[model samples]
Target chain A: MAQQTLEVLQSTDLKPKPDSSELAFGKYFTDHMFMMDYAADKGWQRPRIVPYQPLTMDPSAMVFHYGQTVFEGLKAYRMSDGDIRLFRPEENFKRMNHSSERLSIPPIDEDLMLDYLKELVKLEKEWIPTEPGTSLYIRPMIISTEESLNVAPSNTYTFMIILSPVGSFYKEGINPVGIFVEDEYTRAAPGGTGNAKTAGNYCAAYKAQERATANNKAQVLWLDAIEKKYIEEVGSMNVFFKIDGEIHTPVLNGSILEGITRKSVIELLEHLEMPVQERQISMDEVIAAHEAGTLQEVFGTGTAAVISPVGSLQYKDQDYVVNNGKMGETAKQLYETLIGIQTGRLKDPFGWTVMLEA
Target chain B: MAQQTLEVLQSTDLKPKPDSSELAFGKYFTDHMFMMDYAADKGWQRPRIVPYQPLTMDPSAMVFHYGQTVFEGLKAYRMSDGDIRLFRPEENFKRMNHSSERLSIPPIDEDLMLDYLKELVKLEKEWIPTEPGTSLYIRPMIISTEESLNVAPSNTYTFMIILSPVGSFYKEGINPVGIFVEDEYTRAAPGGTGNAKTAGNYCAAYKAQERATANNKAQVLWLDAIEKKYIEEVGSMNVFFKIDGEIHTPVLNGSILEGITRKSVIELLEHLEMPVQERQISMDEVIAAHEAGTLQEVFGTGTAAVISPVGSLQYKDQDYVVNNGKMGETAKQLYETLIGIQTGRLKDPFGWTVMLEA
Candidate 1:
């Protein structure tokens, strides 16, 4: 297929960018956004960069009623040397197509989409933050736009990429936080839309998240839907445990998200010659390990936090402190290494960082 | 609390109503719609009946990315005496509040909301079809409108009700549909948002529906997410099986929707002194009954098609014809009685119909 032309219509009225220190995640967006429309007859067409503005849609748009939408989150960093970088962006787009398949949405050309993203990032280079911990968060989303109330898959869709200047997830140091184990609510189950980065999966978790907040915890650790025993994820990130001297995480189950950061951490650990295992880790086993004094650490990995260290776990009305309620060695090492590579301060041995021309 | 006043802004240019014979489901909409907004501080304010038009929302609206939405389906019928009536609209509003609770949305005043709906329907009475099977389909929806990317509940929301003139679901008489028993993809699981009439629940089942469609079936019969042995729902509706002259439906498990139509059917059957069991009806039991020549009938219940008779069920590469590929006597009786009561032609002993003053 021939590559589609990229049309750019710069915003004549650009909003003043906020100070880097004042940036909050997804609060402030840049002046321009990338948009594309898809129809069953026209495929994907009318790709353009336009001013960031509100969307006008019919009241009966399928997305408003059916939730046929998917999204991806990544970041663009403004390095100390004044260059822009993206870490393993191709993985995000690839996973997006995988999610699209599950949602019955048409897939975008991965390579072409990546090229367009780089173009978009290049045009919005001035919006990228130069702060030590700040970067520009990119949200690419697709929503069904058909003006029909039918329950079937929509014939029309809208794809958009918006950029937001986000502050550091850990404004202070990487302090360990408490997690509440959720047995009443399930995040994903086998044969469900858990692996897909669709809109429904996120909001379906609000009740449990609210419970965690009420319990004075930083996040909720989700369990398998059936048994409610095996750990699936923590908050919106993949979870990990340091048992004795080795790393352990749940395997690539159908209901758990295939997080890019989770994959990178595994590869990095293997490269560093550390023992890691991907298998079902139940709460019972964790309790057993904690009793045996072998539960060393617990952490979560995702695009936003990268590595969120868990200090204590509240399960069955008991609080189990891990590693004396402190960030463990493995989490600290992984965070520093990943941040260094992402910000272009370290060598990209895995060739995961992609650079955009000024 | 004092009831909020409803403001009216009628549309000057009314749309030409489609012919009752040509009406299709959710296609042609009425001129006016009911809208209300909810904010953290204001609660639900600005209740109004406005012109039906497109919605202008920020590109970063939470509903576009997180699927924080809930909706309801009902209908307004034009009686033979030239009166407009609604069947259990109070029930719909009550259920909508229940759905909103699950999605973490603030509940609306059900009685006041129902009053606003009646006012809106009265204003658009001319759009209601007078044909035997035609009526104005009412869709009430609530969507998260907060312009943020945070994975938390939105602090702002929009609630609206739109009307569409829909034709009869059984234009050529109530023909039974073939169903494919699905063991691959599950509609929902316990601890998930299965009971809520949320947007995510519908689209998440599209993949399995597509599989059923590809197999030349009319709908997918979803099984439980865990064991994949017990029946859950048929497509988006509640399922019922008649074995040995007894009606059996899956119990109100956390993973099954509390359908109003299903409730009505059960009540109607009990009033008629028929045996009805609300318990776990596993696929194993269904198959055994089929082999024993006791699986007399199968059907689905929902708002769109009050009673969708299942002629055959394709399970594990085998087809089991129910009632010899025809609509059973009980399903036919329920459909007629329900339709007669809704159309004001039969006595509504249960007081399910709410008449709207013309």
Candidate 2:
């Protein structure tokens, strides 16, 4: 197949960018957005950067009826040197293809997609927030556009990359959050779409999140669907538990999302000579550790929240507080280091950050 | 709450309707559709019947990214006496609300929704197919319209009812279908959205359906996610088996859909003095029954097919032919009775059909 050329249509009436302080996650969009279409006969074609606008879709579009969609979340940071950098964007595209495979949607050329993304970021460089924790959130998504009610794979799709200027995820500065251990609701199972970065997987957890909120918790800690025993994920992020002196996380067991930040965290820990084990850590083990005074810290990792510390866990009518309801020493250190590397304030030892040309 | 009034807007340009032979499932649409909007503060409002057209949605609508949507399917029939009839549409609306509750979507007033449906169906009565086994398929759906990237319930929603003239589900005249037993992928787990008529639940089964088609089977039979032993559903329909002259179906566990047809079938069986059982039916027990020649017949029930006979079961590299690959007597009876009642030909003893005023 021939390489497709990027077609750019700059917005004629560019809207004023939101003030950095007023920016919330996914609230303020940039003037221009990237879009691509996929037809079964023509492959992915008509890649263009168009003005941000509403989508005109047939009411019978497959995405609205069958949930055949996949999405990736990452950010473009404005470095102190006035250069824009994206943290492991190639990884997001790669994982996106994986998610598309599971959702039965056609894949895009990852390298070409990344090139298009960089071009978009470079064009909208002014939109990238330079605040200490704020950056331009990049949402790459694919939705089935076939106007059919058939419960099958769609013949056409729409892939879009929309940029949003956002404030820091930790609006109150990385404070530890209380989690509700959900036993009544299941996010994913071993043979389901849990691992895929699909829309269904995220929305399916809304009920559990509501229950958590009702219980006065900030987020939910989901357990396995079958046994409701082993740890899976916390809210939308991959979770980590510091037992004794080592970091333990649930293995990528078919159902758990292979979060890019989770992978980077493991690699960073290994580089720093800190112990990290990826295995099935059951709730029993976590509770036992908490009782034994060995459960030092708990945190979640994802593109949205690079490092979210867990202060307490509510499970089976019992509350288990961790590290005195405060962010742990390791969480603080990792958060700072990861943020430093992402913002280009520190050296990129793993070559994880990709710089956009001026 | 005051009952909302429905506004009707006739189509100025009506499209040509397809011939009876050209009628296929959900391929063609009617001239007008019913629509309603729901806001967190205003509830469901502005119910209207407008020209069938495309929907203008924000690119970042929650349904496209988070799958916060639900849908229901039923049919309208054009009776021989020139009257229009709906088969258990009230049940569909009720179940749709149940599905909405599970997906964290606000429920629509079932009575008011049904009134709107009747108004729309009455307006498009000409679209109802009159051919034998043909009807106007009614698809009622609710989609989250909030333009947010957050992984939570949307504050706004769109509810729509689209009509499609559909021919017989069995183009080949009610022939039995071969079933592929899916052991690798799961449709729904105990705590998942399996019972909800949500978009995610349907699309998540696409991969398994593809596998079934590749194996030269007509449909897939899903087992429980936890054990992969008990039969859950067959190609989006409730499954029934006959062992030693007794009708048995999987109980309405949290993972199994509460199919209206399944319920009616059980009721009909009991009225006919046939022994019916709703309990967990394991694959091992099924295989054992087949070995003993007691597995007389197997079939599936849903709004589309009414009753679909299972000719064969492919499991563990072995094919268990049911009733010598022919439609069983009971399945034939149920199909004719259900179709007859739905089409207003047979006596409506159970009052399942709702007729629209001329």
Candidate 3:
């Protein structure tokens, strides 16, 4: 790989980092960030690492009104050997390009972007927390920066990556949480921005998520927009179900996010010689499986939470408990394996982990 | 209305305005703009009119990631007597409040907001374009300001109003245009942010807009997301069709914006003793009407385009020409009356125009 030189402006007065034990998801960030600019005439230019600070833009920036923005979430793990490593960082860049294309944004050179990311992470390696499930969460995003309020694609863009020291998703680690099935509010419709990890899709689900939280559920389980029958995702993660000892998930439809963690889970299952299949699992099928006592487990997979077990599902005024409102065996096993591989505690059988040298 | 004192930050250096003939939509802005802020603890703060400049925000602002933003568009017309007036300015603020609730953003006091708007408009009255078919476009928007990447409501918000001197919708004025029916891509579904004039809805329509432009059409005609048969909107406007001596537009569903211009058109139709019905009009029915030589006119109504006549429609390789691919009598009459009332050229009977004394 050709070495890309990124100009670094280190923060002379670094702010105190948050205590690892009290870290929340996406609340505390490191001292430096990666930023690059794009213009239609000049393409991408001036890639640099700068102090984590505020950005100023014309009040009439297109992103403020058009929502033409896409983002990716990944993490940097502090391995047992005291070296910072990343899990399938390339996948995030690849998916970022996919999202950029869908949002009519200019593409980023993946190799160069990965190099820039590694450089930033290496400089801020002190922020990665290795206590229990704590790690450094990496958020890379792009937004339209044209200083006008028109409906067309932006001629200027800003690609930025910021680091946040995030705690484990579950305080107790791999604990079960309840999810409310969202029937009234659909997540993504086909031929829409559903497959892309854009900002609008997340905004559209907030009301449903709020209602779910009001109903004492931890997350919202989204149904397909057209029919509202098929299960699409849970909150922002890909969902999988274990029914009668067989693992199943919704196939790669055009209206659901192709999550990296979801793919790794399927690959890990296949590697372990477990029974797994990808198909359309309708809500009716889920309910039927629950009634027949064959629904052994339901879990969500994402970069933030490797595996979040579903203890119960609330749908249409009916509550269906999965494994009696307790965590499942498969979920616990998968979580351990995923994080173990990520932190380099276990062997990298799938070659998924990328190690960064000090 | 309670009078509110707004802090003003006047710009010392004012850029030269663009030529009226060469002015484009949302390109050049005025010297000063209106702004206000909101926080969960403090609620809405006192409004301000600051110099038109860039806004500084943390890169991790919630709007960049979750897209929790809403905006409204209206216009100010300089009357024949040189008096500046707004066309239902209060309605925009009222509708904005509704949009704010739908997106889980905080609401502004409509009366105080109106006062602030009038005060700002009064200060920048020189930017209001007075030429025929041209007016000053007013855009009021609210965006999340919290610098966090969580998928929740932002605790802080920035509400700003910017003005752009725009040229006429058509250089020739009230010309007919063709629209391509979008069958594959969907706009908004039920229980989505369609009825609200939010940022995401507009962004979701961009790809379809690009495809329509590529197809050599002026705009895209959206079909309902569920069935993809019922006509939803034309571009970002409410669609109305004249068939068999009656006017028909899609009824207000949960997934279609309640256009202010649409409401006025319906009221104006009633005042003129025309039979108008707000009901679902399927594409099949439209095709049959065109084949029967009864589809007299098709037009779209919005704040930007008062009335856009539909010359023809391209759907599924079939072309249905409306009014022989020419502007019809009803559309011409509606356009004339709408602009006439807006500019005080015709008598106002509905109390729709808000007069601002210079």
Candidate 4:
């Protein structure tokens, strides 16, 4: 394999970085962004970190017409000792490759991409916020660039990585949120692109999300596309339930996104000696558990918010409040432990966090 | 809604027009293309026909991240009397509005938009091919343009129309083509955006299409997402079958695209006093009908091909040839009648063709 070299071109104009407390998710981008291009004739080449700016392309580009695009999200936390840290960043790129295969995009070398990400973080290290729950959110995405209206796999693509300093997901403190079970719009189905982090899956979700928001809820709880009885996911995140002193979540079904945070939560629960099992748990079972007073806690896992406790769930105009609409002990413990591990504050027992040299 | 003003910026340099014999589908565009912009504060505005060129946008545009885009396709034909005509152009714009609503894009005034399209086709009248089956392909698309990575409905959008002079779908003559039944991948679910002409639906289909192409088939015959048994569509077109003397097509299920051509085919068949039915048709039933010698013909209907006869179907590596791999009489008559109506070669019985004043 030919080694690709990075050509860096720093920005001449640099704006003052936002204070960590005021950083908003996906807003206030860094000065530089990583970019690369791929074509049928030329493989992935010209890897570079250029000034963050708009891109120019033909309006008839295939990405706009057909939308063969996939994306990944991760974060870089500023360690207490001033070293930047990444929590299992390799897993994200691995899953990104899985998404690439599903979307028919070219596979990226994980080591090379990780090195590029570390280089980007090193160059924009100052953008890594120091405050609690604050980190530099990294977005790696691939978009078809072939300017053809023909409905086929794109021969050309653009791989880009942009950074954003994010504020705390919980402004005051970790609190429980309300979820509305969605029945109108199905996010994905079996033998679909649900497992892949593709743009369409996210696009299909907005309608359900809008409905949830309109009803004063935080997010939509997606049911299985086939039966619409089984629980699949909560918004873009993976869902987990603590019922009768056992931790349960839907298995790695083809229609549910394989969330890295969800995996970590399961591992953390097992490590804490709490019984954890990945199984098909239906909404009816959840409702029955709630009625039987065995539904102890409900939470969602993702890179953005880590673990968000669900205080209540609304299904067909009926509200199922969990644990008196409060965060349970297990939810609190998992949040703190996972957050601590991610920020390099907790002891490294599983070697999940990789520390970067300052 | 306030009437939007039309702005025109004519292209200074015009390329030599391609010969009708050498035209290719979706290849070689006209000198000018229509463009429009929409924002939350200012609605859809500044409709213009500018020089065909590339568009510049931020890499963080929502369309790249969320795939919130929809499109419509139609054609304008050059008559034998040196006049230009459009078939159901208003219907295309009305369907575009349907797509826009499904995609959370602001609705476009169908009448005003139809006027702009008429103006565009009138300006590009010379580009309309005069060949037997060739016409100027019209593509109208709306894409989210908001520069945010957040997964939500875009506050800004761009709607544009581009015209393409095309070759005939059948170079020599309309003939039958083979289809591969897609049992592995599901195109769209019941509650998904299957009916909407969205980018994601097309993107999700390319894999199945590629598989069919690899197996020497012309297109993929999609099945219902849930059971994977009932017929939905055949590769971006509506599927139709002729059993004995009656015509049958899949009902307008939420997962089946409501093709305008399909609607026209039913109306034309009813006008000809042929019995037609729209209901659930399964693969097993089709195979049973074939074995029982009741399956007479299979065809697909769309704006591009008008009526395409399916000569063969491959299911589980088994090929089922229809009408001994020959075009059926019904398929032939429908194809010729539809083409004649579209190209201004036949009498206007349904008033489907709208002739533009040049």
Candidate 5:
């Protein structure tokens, strides 16, 4: 860990800027970025804030061939006092390091990373959108920089942070979306790198997502690999269901990412004096509950979508709508409470927000 | 299909060149290189041969985040008469494009790519190690170049060629290596990106490979995902077993990579009036054959190893040795035949070699 200050390099006039209103999710980026390099001789180098520019690398870098990369996605919110704040920044840092360790990449100092992120947000505060549900999306990534074709852990690496402003995850806001129950393909396996936020996990889920999209669905609801019966996740998000007046979610099975939002929701539920359970929930159980009219709601939690109310699930050619295809009351309460905490409207009793210096 | 002439950025100096006899795999590189760019508006740009220099890419490139990349590996052998020849490079080109299509990345023109490669090998001819069982390894890669964080395909890409001088797949001549059967985790799955020669596939195999190494084995032997009983591939290479005087291999089944060497071996076997069967062979069947002394040989085929003999298989706390834990007659014959065809020592009646101008 070093206290070296960030070296800033602003983008020149030639760099095109996108329209704020027309920002299409992650398709647009900010003017400057953060980067740090790791070599066998020198440890993590002096972190720098530079003009968003192309990285100079050998054609045979290990990351280009072995997929030795990991990344984290979180957002910075604009407060009423014109200040930028990150929600649960420590959680993101912890998860990013966990992903890095799993991918054999070097971990960053949590305090150093938080300080650097705060400085980055303070410098690019204007990029924090004021629109409801809109914010500055920050992507922190680490890649193997060793210039060799051998199949081994890299001796050189680079850690970089890039920002992009995005609109609401649920574009229509609080609307219910359909999901295809993915049984044929597993995003990850037990004793595998599934829990790590690595690039391969997302790539593994793409085919199922493509199939889901082709069928006019939003995402794929993944199942456990062993029997393909137990619900694992929604690929990129953790899932929660309401049945018998209790909030239930699949426990951390090492095959699903331990999402920050998932933890936040569980804590929020417990704080609100609601019954919450974390255990393996099988597909048969869910179907039986739906048939018995006991299945109340289903929603997914992620940084992108604070809460996505699942309207219907298509499994084995059978469709089952949740709560008559409406956003559940529990989902609505969780969404509002979470967003309120993120935007500083709620009390900071949980100590989630890390405000950047103005 | 633009025919813009390729710009040549020749290397300024040869630098400190390594001796051919002491060359390590993927450590030493050539001086000149080939590259091209593609964009949604511009399509595939004209190819180029440039000096071997570091490539400049955006820190936020999709390849860094989503692993939107694929690559191919082949070699350029220096014939006795000083001409350079490639073994079935067309197969490599075709497979690379197939992998790109799966990843949603654009493909390169075959003729143009070959032309660029020829130009590069011609300029860097001095780096080709003139030794038996050794050649200059050629690596071609495609990556997303767009500086965006979107999960979808990128609008821009770069295709580049790099050359690395290598010794041989086996350091101790053509000896047989042992394999550890992996039953818990799968390398690839059905209806997934298994058949594609993508980076993610190789990365996914690393953990299994690590397990094999820790267990003092050479490679990981994969099994079918559905039953975990049938033999599949050994990561990068295709598997083959000689049983009851017949050559048998697992069928493609959409989950196995259609290896070029695998196809070549089948053709060569049929040409020699030998029985070659492409069907499922269960692990139990293989073990039973070994116990009954019917399984004579086991080997793997790929561009890197050409023909790698498997001396033994370790599975379920048991060891099954083939041909008394030594290379079998069939393994030796296939290796000699394939190497002969590649090194210009024997006639390539199939017209597989693509010669490059000196």
Candidate 6:
């Protein structure tokens, strides 16, 4: 393992930061950011925490032209004991590196990167919200910095982590939202980068999501590309369905993201003695089950929201309301259990929480 | 028709730039760039030509994270009589807006955008190269600029065009180069963004291209994602084969880009009274044709290279050298005819060339 020497620099002129309650997602940034450089000869260099500033990248930077970038999102929470904690950050770290590998980016020492993250969290512990349902969101991104039009993995790269004080992900709290099933376009393919947390996958879905929003839907649901019959994902989150008294999700078909929150939901469901299965569930099946009165519930899971209960689905000018257009019992239970464990209200049997020093 | 209101900002520090012969691809840029903004309320603003400088974009810009960006590349050439001309520029403009529509980006007025491009080119006439195989490359790009994390098209967007002085596309000149037949990863898929000139499509092919270069190949020969047996593209360019006295290229499937140059090549071949067919050509059939001495020639085409002849194809540890590892007669003829028309050596039969005031 290579030792990382962190260079620290404090901001000279800091603005009067916004209050935690007034904070919006990814809007207000922290004073300092963690950064590191990668090169062919040096592998990965020492990390640094410096004052936040605009990047001086060349116009021909590969990231600007080729979209050779990947990022991860997580949060730091302030516990009742005045200590900061992170929920399964290692999982995020591992998944990020996996995404990097798919984009042909150089891998980093997860332990060293985690240590640097912890140090940043410690230094900016004040940014962590003390209010309920708020925390400091951390964005770790890697971009190609090489100044060339050549379509190749950059010889030089920058990995940086920025912190943002954020409030609730959904403006309407945990109320069920409407989603439209995307028909014309597909997000990822069987052998595509859909499974990886790359920027391209999200960007590809932006247009369809916009159309859905214009049609009065909150999110867009994606189906498999081959047949466009099987359910894939819901934009940024993995979807779950309760059918015939059982919890089920679309299988990891190399085209659906293996969301961290999705995994946690499965574990929580299994712990609660609920039957769960991951399989190729089609749209026809979902519609048939809804009409047969066995659909029970529908929801999505991601780090942004512990669980997003989906109230209705719109497809081809037709609307299907789930469970009377309200949040279901299973979704409510899952959200509360996950949020309780995250906020230290419930005991964590999986050792998924990591407490930080004040 | 939307009247174009050009806002001109005269640059103060315009340098006496270097001559075209010493130009490197995408290195030296023009003094001015054309920009326009798009919003939901205001569809697209009037275009403006301002002094080129680094844009002050928010750190959470969609282009910087989710890769919500698309770009088009074409060039302005200096004719013998000191007049500037654009080769099939309408095709490039039409295709760019098509890409925008598919990516859910707001489309620009093609006529106004063209007028703005012409005005910008007129101002930067000195940047156009007079040397052979050299010209001023124009890059028009659109990016989402909303400083939010929601997976949707930005309510605001920035459309900009920058010019770069470039030499020949190939570093060592266009000699017959070896191509690796890639059977593993794919660049795009059916019902995907492959048809759009999006950044993600190029980035996805980078790793495989790098591996091909590492193995002493100039490019990777892309196969269809399903079964991986049929020829699709050469990744960056569209592939063409001369078998049994006829020209053959892959039909534009949803998984492959419909290159402007590819269309031109097909047109040129037909104009030359040669038989051409756009159909699926399998790898086994290609090998059989090669072994039976029916494979007359093989080449790839794009705006960057015009035409790049293939020396050999490496597939599964086997090498199949085309035409004794040299450029074929058919490939040479096509290259000469295409280059002749672009450089004004041949008659403009299709009125494809648009001359600009120098």
User: What is candidate 4's CA lDDT for residue B17?
Assistant: 95
Off by over 4 Å in 3: A1-5, B1-4
B1-358, model 2: which lDDT tens digit per residue? 2686678899999999899999878889999999999999998899999999999988888998899999999999997678999888889999999999999999888888888899998889888888888999999999999988877899999999999999988777878999999999989998899999998987898899999999999899999999999999999899999999999999999999999999999989988999689999999999999999999999999998999999999998899999999999999999889888988889999999998996
**Candidate 2 has what TM-score?**
0.99
lDDT of each: 0.93, 0.92, 0.90, 0.89, 0.84, 0.84
Deviation in angstroms for A14 in model 4?
1.7
Per-residue CA lDDT of candidate 4, range A31-138, in tens?
Answer: 999999998888899999999988887877889888899899999999667988998999999999998887888898888999889989999998898888899999
lDDT (Cα, tens digit) per residue for candidate 5, span A81-139: 89677989888889988887767677888889888888787877877887788889998
Give the TM-score of each candidate.
Answer: 0.99, 0.99, 0.98, 0.98, 0.91, 0.93
Tell me what TM-score chain B of candidate 3 gets against the true chain B: 0.98
Candidate 3 vs candidate 5, DockQ winner: 3
Candidate 6 residue-wise lDDT, A180-285, digit = tens: 9998778887667888888788778877887788889999999887788899999689999998889999989888889999999999888889957999999999
Assess each model's interface with DockQ, reporting 2 decimals per model.
Answer: 0.90, 0.86, 0.76, 0.74, 0.47, 0.55
Tell me the native contact fraction for each prediction. Answer: 0.88, 0.82, 0.70, 0.63, 0.49, 0.49
lDDT of 5 by residue, B1-358 (tens): 6677888877777767687667777887888778888989999886788778898887778788888788888988996689788988888888898887777777777777877778888888877877787899999998887877777778898888999988867767878888999987677766556788777777667667878888889999999766788898985789999998989999998679999899999999999998689998899999999999999999999888999999889999798888988888888898999888888888898998888878
Which docking band does candidate 2 fall into? Answer: high
Task: Give lDDT tens digits, candidate 1, residues B171-192.
Answer: 9998999999999898889999
Q: In model 6, which regions exceed 4 Å deviation?
A: A19-21, A170-173, A314-319, B1-24, B39-46, B79-81, B170-173
By DockQ, the candidates rank as 1, 2, 3, 4, 6, 5
DockQ, 0 to 1 scale, candidate 4: 0.74
**Which has the higher DockQ value, candidate number 3 or candidate number 6?**
3
- Quality of candidate 3 docking, DockQ: 0.76
| Evaluation by lDDT, superior candidate among 1 and 5 | 1
How far residue B308's Cα lies from its native spot in candidate 6, in Å, is 1.3
Model 1 agreement with the true structure over A216-316: per-residue lDDT tens digits: 89999999999999999999999999998989999988999999999999999999999579999999999999999999999999999999999999998
